[model samples]
Target chain A: MGKDQILVRVRDLHKVFHRGSERIDVLQGLNLEVPRGDFLAFMGPSGSGKTTLLNLIAGLDRPTQGAIDVDGQRIDQMSEADLARWRARHTGFVFQLYNLLPVLTAERNVELPLLLTPLSRAERKRHVQTALSVVGLADRAQHYPRQLSGGQEQRVAIARAIVADPTLLLCDEPTGDLDRKSEDEILDLLQALHREYGKTVLMVTHDPHAAARAQRILYLNKGTLSAEPIE
Target chain B: MRFWPLLWSSLWRKKVRTTFTLLSILVAFLLYGYLAAVNKGFSLGINTGADRLFLRHKVSLSILLPESYLGRIGATPGVVDVVHATWFAGIYQEPKNIFPQLPVDPERYLRLYPEFLLPEDQKQAWFADRTGAVAGRTLVEKFGWRIGDRIPLVSPWRKQDGTSTWEFTLRGIYDGAAEATDTRQFLFHYDYFEEARMFGKGMVGWYIIRIHDPKRAAEMAQRLDSNFANSFHETKTMTEKALVQGFARQIGDIGTIIGAILTAVFFTILLVAGNTMMQSVRERTAELAVLKTIGFSNHLVLTLVLTESLLLAGLGGVVGLGLAYWAIERGDPTGGVLPVFFFPPNDIVLGGVIMVALGLATGILPALQAMRLRVVDAIRRA
Candidate 1:
């Protein structure tokens, strides 16, 4: 799709958090456009607020001073419940540590997001199985988190993110906790999902190689977005 | 929601802690059940005690009234029949082997309660012989008293010439037809003790009046008491229930004390279980935060945590109730004091309700924390 078919559009977005005595500005007058099916990466230092901007785009948090439109809906103005339902229908998320509930097996962890929808048990099982198979962990579906290796757990997390058939996929330091080999494997999975399934992936990371795997790389410094050149 | 598997796995994770929690709930509910059953154990009106009421001398229970009063009281209004008795306050050959020995009029006593299942032939044989006695089933088993055998009871009050054995033949052993009273008392002919003639001459300790309508008992007691008031001896009459309860109250306010203890126990369980749920939810802060960021509604998260806590409590409650059932069924050290001891159905239901309430109340703190946590901070906690 063209840039006119942007999946995420932010206009002068700002976020401020209250910590005991004063306010801390995380995102200051940010702007961005993410087209449908584009693999994009946001690279920044620890306190640069890249994740804050992603949360706004994913409808996870409200921006204090601006508007965010994701797939034609202005999410900043939606009610918490509406935003949650919208996020369930439109957004998917992956984290560095996988964040899988230790108690659930791989398939059940993948099946978590589907529980929010009105899908039948069979439909849920099918979705979980397909997602796990997509991540090449179909055989590991019955294994608990403790039974899996780190990279395997992350792949399961990715499977969970996409199980709901969401429009936007968000990853926060998706390979920050993995070894180089595992990181490359994860980047490969992200690339495959983007290229084959045509998913819109917004990743935040410090690793340049991870960003190089994206169709576009953007830099965020002190709550402002800038361009980045990937080799 | 599909949270059951999550809860089950979480409970199974730390086996020792889970087991400890379950056991704690078990013990708590056991105490609750026993206390509740102790409350139920006070129900009287069975076998030996229910069918009889001691119409004591008007001045005091210990005061001996003349035999002439018994004939008159038996003919009073609402009176079906009457039996007169004197407490021997005896011990079996040994000083420590104490028991209540009663000198009773067998003929009229046999007419009062038809539920005391004794053979007609045995009753006739015992009533014909002056020195015959009928022991309760429990008493018979207790002392191995057989039919046509002699039981020598030593009375402390009616001793004569330093000898106290009031020997009587055990013509028959009887069983009570109700569930309440213990079958552990002894009954025999009063003429035997009176015929000894060494003590209590022409006098009876008390009279027991069996009424036709137990509901009109209060008025009957009043009539019985007024009939003998201001005489050389006076009578204090009461219903069989009131008399039994009065005897129990003489010990202490056990039911009230038990009620206070149960209230305290329930409060403690609520706090302890609530605190436990709070700690568990706190431990899952980051996970809950992740749920929020993934678009779980504040309400869903709140309900999820609360349900998790209640699930824990519910599981604990079932185990506790089960343990309580076993303990009560097996009996306690209070041995036969709580004979009808069992947890009431409502108590188990109450436990369920309290578990849900305590779990929800405690979970609210952690859930609110989760709902209020900044989404950015939540994910940042990593």
Candidate 2:
């Protein structure tokens, strides 16, 4: 509980989903902690609740019953409005589909999160340029999502995530839609962002190859977390 | 970087659908503008000052009053001058070619209507020759009539030797001196008309009186009507505005009809535009979810949806209003109902208000749906 020792903590987390008369528990009494600057990956079967735990930790979904402490704040108790503000200031997300806006070019897409900030126009532009450069997509800043290759689009999404310099990076199946070469390129970019910026990363994926790149890998089976990382 | 570029790009993402929706909106607003002008024209008369009063037979305008009423009306204390006219009901060539033709005492009538500017020489010529007539500039231009040309009018009221045709030599063309003055009349000598008519002799259709003070118009109208009350031919005296409004009312309930038509039109537009907005929002569910994840508040997402729909409507509304204005400026192409029509500033303002309201109405439900969408659910659906 010392300052800077831990970035995210969870205790007895439970998530339930209901369909008509049937109730399904996605996560049950989950307990874990992610220290600052650690890159953790969650891998499980499709219905093993790996993604649900990731969403809960990222404050993207509310847990049915549990405590989610991220950056010393109990996000489980935060209001939707407050959660959005907290997410803006503390978390960045990357999804399997790259999820970049099709209409905007790479630079403007990277500038999206900065728009929510109080940064001046010049400062925002410089930050956007730096983020794009870090992802090695500087020359393709003006290219739209459709104009970029799969790897390039994922790189743009990564640039968008880190543009506002959030402390926590939550990625969901980042390489789920890419080929082997593209997946390797994205994995490399994520590793560089984590090592250079000291970002705390939690990624959910079905690919063990993608998981092996993380500093520590955890397994979720039947809504429960495990210490073992299987190749 | 600004909100506008996002809004603009989102609105035009489906260019074909947006363009068609905008065209429909444009057409609706165009109808709104032009119909407003037409409605105004139908309900409004020449904006005469309060000094003018029209006296017609109480039973109906077609019922004529005795010629002796002229002198009595002029003798009234507040009345400065009185001029009487009889409807000629003349058809120029075809039966469909109909316009207002009246026979009046030229000298007196000209004095009463200072807005009709006629040349002194032409006035003298029209007065000297009983067969000569004066036409407005609009009438002359419409029929391509010139001075010294004999214009034949087929009269339904009178016939001479089995033919109902009467011919008059066009002597002069007068123009309107003021904004409200109508430049579409055909006037000739009342003396010649009275002497030649086979029946209804010595009777005039209506009397036009000019008073000294506008404040006394209602009092004068009441007093004048009372003077002819209980007589063989009772009189109804009213100001020129009331008289014109009465005539327009006799045609139909213009306000209600226009209101009903506009309501139907706008309601149809609302449904069509609302459906488009809903479809647009539904297609962008994942994008909206992405926005929420990126720290866009629920209210901000709602505003973005509303702003995009409003921009679509606003674009169409402006273009529609412009087309309406252009069409009105070129005058009514039909060249029948609306003789001289233009879109008033008030109507333009009204159309703009309708456009904005329509945008809000069409956008609200879809925006609300977008606002209430769960990011997790939205992303899953996408």
Candidate 3:
């Protein structure tokens, strides 16, 4: 069925900035698409526009020119407020650094986005508990971000992202700041979630092993994108 | 997510800075409360008064008005009644124990000012007995003066030939029924003072006039002045509040001055709070940038930072207002010279407004700064 339709489409997206009156282009006419339930990794060198492209798709920044459609909503045409509401309802993001609020308990961090929804406190807590359990850190739900190990913290971040039950999960170098064991554990969790939950996953990573988990891979080089199948 | 916990915990992250900012806010609000109270006190019952007016010499208060002017003013249209008064400028035997004296016509005075609760019999006794004097409850308590005790008052306006010369019998103790009226004054019959043949005789300092209708006060005042306008002595008519304000007026434009002080204080607080918020947002730049990348908008990041600023300023305002309430409520039992020493409900409301203003002012720049940050750049900041 046409690969069950496209979940996200980026067409002729371009991003430029001025550095002291000089035009500096980060992404030039880059086009990409992700099918439903696809696990894709974007790989590139520094300044290859990998992160830039991810940001554009995430609607975190406005491109000088282009159109991005996620689930039939032309996000590039949406107001900042509409985009925020859409992100709140539909996207889960994990970062290289665990960006959990340090003052909140792990459970509270996971419960953040759920607050924006109509879920009751009891339901939110239930979801938080289940997500933390899925992360194998149910015992650590009461701990602050500072009290958790790097891997534990990232696991908490992952739990927070998924607790909202979003359609898509975006991870940027999720294993880049971890030790080998932590990296392996994260990769295992990501693979399990992709296999069992059927969540569409997109990851930006330098770790070949991390990318190996993806169903497909995309290479971004100096403001351009190329699709490639995983080995 | 609910913004309140996010706002609250944001401040908890910088404990020292938050505490200091709160202290600064507390001090600023405390000052604001005191200044507002002073402005209120200075104009208290006078500005809105219903039953009183002062009849003083047009030229100056220090200059005396002829006692004869009382008859004409009392007879003026819409004039309910009138009484004569002069600042006796009397001294209690000791320099430290000072009390103001007014040589008043007891009969007309008691009839005019019902705010002073004194028995009609005692007032009559004071009038009949030439040496009799009446003291307010505050003066009686402060100096331990008893009724029927013979006390000597040294006159500042007209000193006796002898050092310890002036003498009078204390006949009645009076209490002011309202805050606007002074409870520290000593009143003796003008007849008694005239009997002593004291200086400034036949010439009273001012007149207290009560009118039939308060609404016609301005009109009656004009009539009273016009009656004496071309006469040998010119008179000025004003409400008792204006008279009281006149006394407080020697200190200059208190309202304008107080406004300037409050502005300066609020501006200083704004700068202080702004700097604090700026630093807070700068420190959290990476975190906020991350929030943005996760689909939190620039507006949301701005809102978070602004909410933190508001929380800080609001908490500070509440703290400061509480302190002011305690200080003023715990002050002098006898109504300290600054009698209207109250952190009024309006002042609390004003503090609330200030807190809101400060919060908005302090938050805007930090919020804008956070909003303008490049997500990629912030994540890479060392």
Candidate 4:
């Protein structure tokens, strides 16, 4: 694979869930590709399997019968242990609710993923400082999630997601719980991460405005992915 | 950044719940310490010197042995010296007031038991007057007895008529060399008892023999018993440790009782702790999913939960045992019912082990549940 080539390759992926004796098919023969350093957003209705597709790409869930290749690794076929290591090294995640550990301070929360790495204490401290500075939460490093406002908490969550310098950053409705002003700030941060740091981004959201901030937008309709023209 | 700080804060997140849980664990370990001391007191004979042997009547401890057999026992090949004593079972003030009132050959008894530390003046006073007695320091303090104070003694076995009643002047108060040694015994001259008693004049309760070599105790015991074999009153000779252990066993199986009580206590504690851990993990379901999404492996999550549980239980255990040690040092909260209570170092070690085991047992299920959580579902629920 060459530079600026396809970084994620999904071919005919299907995901089905079984509730007792009833089978619910979430995804049906989906195919998609994301170029290196591209910021792609997914918009879909409820139960349309946009989150399922993102989870599969992030190595958090397995596909029923298909192939998912991220960073040149067939993550769908990886064991649970190997997949976890893979996720740690290559993937960062931002949740809609900002998913910051309530007991930890903002800096400590950002340093969570770095614990999986072999970095020294000084190195980890530097990385945490950098991540917090990038998100404009350097002064709020000592504040816990409960101590910060909604937008500040999301910034800390974003800092935590990017602290380890993961190859891909997956956001699940990153602005779902934020006001318009906070959403604009978070969208600007995501744009800066993609343009300045050359980070690949995949986000699943229901808001068209959140999708419009991405370089490319895909709509999931009737279990099939289709590009929506950005005007 | 480190697992330690994360675990510490997680446990303290709900201060009230954690404090109460810790208090329960503290109570459990405190009970463990005191119960362990009581068990140690009941099973009190394993620490005796092997050179000593106690020879008693084979039929029963209450049965009398012939005093003439003492000479033969002393003449045995391995015998160093033979001392004889008889229980007077005397009561003072009321029937509830009880103490060891044994009459012994004072010189021989004191020589055999060097652990009973007595002053030279007290020894001479007892030997000087046949009607004088030596009491332990604890007994003297407990009853406020002073030197030259005549103590009236009554025996239930013997009718305490005017002539049959006994009185002795307290001449000395003895201390114990070691904590396990009993310092509450009342030792008087056997010559006085033999002369004053109406019946069983030449009979003694038991004979204590000191051997030159402790390893030769079994051989000497066999030789002494064989000498009294088929005689008027046969003898059963055993090491002093074994004899004390037998007496302890006759009361009840203290070790088994302690084990059962501790088992019940720990089982209830396990349920309480396990329920708390389960609730904690359950409430943090969404947070755990966030951890997994951020690349925390399943094993790390499980270990984090377990470590939190261990920290909670271990903190409580140390505090509780520290309190127990303090109480033991303060001495007999029950006011002398348990005379030989002590908190041995080994009991502290055992309590620590129980704390760790309880932590593991209570945390394993909840930790596994945390490990098996599906990140997608947890995030969805949140």
Candidate 5:
């Protein structure tokens, strides 16, 4: 694929964490390239650095050594404030636990990302309504997180992620906290977002069933990626 | 401005804790308001006529000076007129009903203190009747007294007839021209008091001298004191403001006392409010991380936290001061003890500034903590 078609590129990535004086290498000499509209999944054990790699690409974190370019921008070299602005403009995140503000209604939670924009209040409200409708949660807009079921909460979270129309959709075990039925529903929604909107998607998951739904799956072990599934 | 709702909702996240914290702030500011009013009342006399001087006994306010010195003071250069008043130390029926009762030459005292607004007809009546007295409007309201009423007071100093009771006809009720003027005094003719008193004849408490040019008051005061330098009753002379301030200092340094008390109260409030903000931020750690994930910069998070704290403090302060204003309007609850009991406009402005400062002080640490939170670590902990 052409360089312009590659939405995320990680070259010679290395991440090390320290606890007191001990050094822990989470990801070392890892490389990755995810093309636009590709649905990619990183499968690994709990300490295999799947989330770390995803965070570096999302500009939520910086690598110990490497280059992370997202949508042609060198995010690894960006300052914290610039990274924040870049993330707001180009990335959407869906968390496993549906980290919606308990004090805000579903509509308000969905409208969170739009507050950074200079959009009029009426325009923001319309955009929030459209995003909630896309996630099949338009009817539940006024309900608070406590009033919604786990699946519904995740749907609201998805609406919030897409409300800004970011270029890359990142999910970190988006269905990890749901029942099997709700898990399938979230996975289907992720699939629909990728297939219909042609959005670049990157997800980290340990579940084989969830990995099976992605267009490409890479297993991480010993701080490196492999095409073969982990035994 | 769009973040206001978010800040407000976050402030009330834990309703019980937020409510109790708000109440604590309210009570602190309420105490602040009342104490400020009390301090203003105690210092009210200091703001009176600057062009006037007081000539009193060199020893103490309780020591009497010869009444003959009033004429000498009035004859001095730059001295326009002079009046003398003696403290009666009298109470009406009960010691709790004690208020200032001064014996003065009615006409001269009225001329010296034009701020005491007495009707011309009543002034004539008071001058015509030797046993007539005039009560301030505040005193009249407190005792429900009216003109033509017989009022009796018991003085600590017994009369020549071995009786402590003194009777006078209420000829008038005088109002104050300014809000800060003391309207809790009872003024009676000095002739009646001097003729009936057992001792201290031909003596007065203090002489109030009105001068032509206030700029020359100090020089005139020095000149008057020299006139009695080596006499049997040596005199100490000072401007009216200084005399009132000296009297206040004799009781206590009211400003320092009020400052110390307010400092203690606000310090305790800062701790309470700071702890509350910290707890609120701690509970929202994961939520804050989510915000960061959605592109909220550290600076934005810090601003949100600080704004939340300011909103809480400002709300409590405004409400507390409003309640204090209402209570002051209902009048002083201490009977007639505090003569000038209204909250000063400057103090209200100071209260507003303190509220903002309190908000920032209580919020800084927690805001820094929120700002320094690493999104990855915070989410993992959550």
Candidate 6:
């Protein structure tokens, strides 16, 4: 793929963690490329470095070695402050637990990322309304997280992730804690975000059903990726 | 300003905890306000007058000074005028009803202390009637003593006929020019007191001397004291402010005592407030990590936490000081002991500064912890 076509390029990546005096290597010699608007999923057992790789790509963790270039900018070498600014402009994140600030209503939760921007209050309100409407939670704008079901809260989280109109959407087990019906709904939302919105999506999930919805699936084993799917 | 709602909401996330913490801070500041007012009252003389000097018996305040020494003091250089007053240890109705009753030459005393605002008619009325007395507005109101009413006081000093009661008609009520001025005194003509007394007829409690230049007051005081240094009654001369401070010091080191109490209170409050912020941050670790994931910088997170703390302290402090001011306005609780009782403006400002300092002291550690939190670890732990 052309350099412009590839949105994320990871080369010779390594990640190490330490617990007291013991050393544990999470990811080693990992290389991957994600094309623009591609829906990619990483599947592996727990402790197989699937989430670690996703974290590195999202600039939430720095690699022990090698480089990460996102949209032609070398993110691995960027300072923490610079990475934060880049993330604000280019990335959105959705977690499995649907991490919504419980004290805030759905509308306010969706407005979180917009607060970082210099958008006028009216403009931010419009953006939040549109993001909530896109997630089909417009009618529940004033409902707090405690007032909503697991599926509804996850929908609110998705609205927050997209409120800022970021370039990359990273999901770590986005539907891991949901019921089967809720899981299908979230996966459908993710697919719509990718196919309809043309978002570059990277997700880490252990569920084969969730993995199958992605355009490409990579199995992480022994700190490397392969085309074969995990059982 | 845009983030105020977020900071406010975070502060009250745990309603019970926040309410208790707020009450704790309120009580502490309220105590601070009362103690600071008391300290100000005790040290009121420091702000009284720089140009006026007081001359008393060098041996002790209880020891009387000869009234004849007033002429010698007035003759000294830098002395503009001199007046004398003798303490009348008198009580009204009951012994518990205590207040300052002084016998002074009405004209001279009124001329020297102009802060005592009395009407001209009342001054003439007092001078015309030999048995006339003028009471401060505060004392007049306390005992419901109206002008033209005859009030009798029981004194330990007896008349030549062995009677312990003295009667005088209330001629006027004097108001204080400033809020902190002691308006609880009762002043009457000294000639009547001298004629009625059985002994020590030519003695006075203290002499108040006005000088030409305030800056040379210490030098003038030394000159005045030397005039009586070798006489039967040696004298000590000092500024009126020093005399008031000396009287207050007899009660103990009020400033140090109040300071020690306030220090203990604030330290305890610091621990309580600090632990509260620490717990609040710890409980919201996952939420803070999510905020970071959404592109909030570490500095922004730190600011949010610190702002939350400041809001808490500021709210409690403003309300506490406000309540204390209201209580002080209601009047002194200690009947007549603390005559000059009111919260000073400077103390209110100091309270505000302490509130900010307390907030910063308690918020810093927790804010730093929030700032240094690694997003992945916090998320995983949560």
Give the top-scoring candidate (DockQ): 6
- Over the stretch A1-231, how does candidate 5's per-residue lDDT look in tens digits? 898998888899999999999999999999988999999999999999999888888888899998988888899999899989998999899998999999999999999999999998999999999999989999999999999999999999999999999999999999899999999989999999999988788999999899888999999998999999767
Residue A72 in candidate 3 has what lDDT? 81
Model 4 Cα RMSD, 1 decimal:
4.7
Is candidate 3 or 4 superior in lDDT?
4
DockQ of predicted model 2: 0.57
What is residue B145's positional error in candidate 3, in angstroms?
10
Candidate 2: residue B126 Cα off by (Å): 14
**Residue pair clashes in candidate 2:** none
Q: Is candidate 2 or 4 superior in lDDT?
A: 4
Ten-residue stretch with the least lDDT total in model 5 chain B: B1-10
Docking class of 5: medium
User: Which one wins by DockQ: 2 or 6?
Assistant: 6
Tell me how each candidate scores on DockQ against the true complex. 0.56, 0.57, 0.44, 0.63, 0.70, 0.72
lDDT values, one for every candidate: 0.78, 0.87, 0.81, 0.88, 0.91, 0.91
Candidate 2 regions exceeding 4 Å error are: A120-123, A229-231, B46-52, B59-71, B74-204, B209-223, B230-233, B238-242, B249-255, B334-339
* The candidate that achieves the highest TM-score relative to the unseen native structure: 6
Model 6 TM-score (2 dp): 0.92
Query: lDDT per residue, candidate 4, A124-193, as tens digits?
Result: 9999999999999899989989999999999999999899999999999999999999999999999999
**Candidate 6 residue lDDT tens string, B1-382:** 7787688889999999999999999989998998888887888757876789999999988899988988888888889889999889999999889899999999999888889999999989999999999999989988998999999999977989999999999999999998777889999989999999998889999999999999998889898988987888998999988888888889988889999999999999999999999999999999999999889999999999998999889988899898888887787787778768889888999999999999999999999999999999999999
Question: What TM-score fits each model?
Answer: 0.79, 0.82, 0.82, 0.82, 0.88, 0.92
**Considering only N, C-alpha and C atoms within 3 Å, which residue pairs clash in candidate 6?**
none
Please give the lDDT score at residue B257 for candidate 4. Answer: 81
Task: Indicate the worst ten consecutive residues by lDDT in candidate 2 chain B.
Answer: B332-341
lDDT of 2 at B92: 83
Question: What is the C-alpha RMSD, rounded to one decimal, of candidate 5?
Answer: 3.5
Clashing pairs in 5: none
Comparing 1 and 4 by TM-score, which wins?
4
lDDT of 3 by residue, A11-75 (tens): 99899978899988989998988998889999988777777777767766688899998888888
* After superposition, candidate 5 runs with Cα above 4 Å error: B47-51, B60-64, B77-81, B88-98, B101-135, B143-178, B187-203, B211-222, B249-252
Better of 1 and 6 by DockQ: 6
| Backbone steric clashes in candidate 4, count | 0
Candidate that beats the other on TM-score, 1 or 5, i.e. the better one: 5
